[model samples]
Target: MSLYMLPLAIGPWQIALIVIIVLLLFGGKKIPELMRGLGSGIKEFKDASKEEEIEKNDKKE
Candidate 1:
């Protein structure tokens, strides 16, 4: 058996609405701080993954 999934059809208006909602929820002043924290979290996740890969490689050799 196989399962199929359909992707969401998001248009420009949908995107604009989402942006407006986020802006209203987070406010302009907080967006930059949120983005900075998000970026740092992503960087830390990548660094951890790389370290795990290196450890696996070291264990095999």
Candidate 2:
């Protein structure tokens, strides 16, 4: 029996290539808008989780 292992290393060139690809696909202007949307979504999710925790603690008392 043989087991295969995938490489798990990322170097600077690999990162640069990925950035180039993303820029090409999304364009320079749309990238900032996409990032802003993603950041807001993450913030909203965290806020919702915090509210749920607060409600749970109140119910316990």
Candidate 3:
């Protein structure tokens, strides 16, 4: 039963490697823009999903 909680761990080296990959993929100058675009897209998706749920509820009512 206790096996489910086996600790999840990420070390500093793993973080550094992820950072290096991001920098190489996006380049230093583009990272911020990419992040902003990602943020906006995620927010838009969330809003669209919520709107659809609300519309469904309204139709049911």
Off by over 4 Å in 2: 1-8
C-alpha lDDT score of every prediction, in listed order: 0.91, 0.92, 0.91
Clashes of each: 0, 0, 0
Q: Per-residue CA lDDT of candidate 3, range 1-61, in tens?
A: 2665534466788889999999999899999998999999999999999999999999999
Question: 1-61 in candidate 1: lDDT tens per residue?
Answer: 2233324666798999999999999999999999999999999999999999999999999
Off by over 4 Å in 3: 1-9
Best by TM-score: 1
Clashing residue pairs in candidate 1, if any? none
lDDT value, residue 28 of candidate 2: 100
Worst 10 residues of 3 by lDDT: 1-10
Q: Model 2, 15: alpha-carbon shift in Å?
A: 1.2
Candidates 1 and 3, the one with greater lDDT: 1
TM-score of 2: 0.80
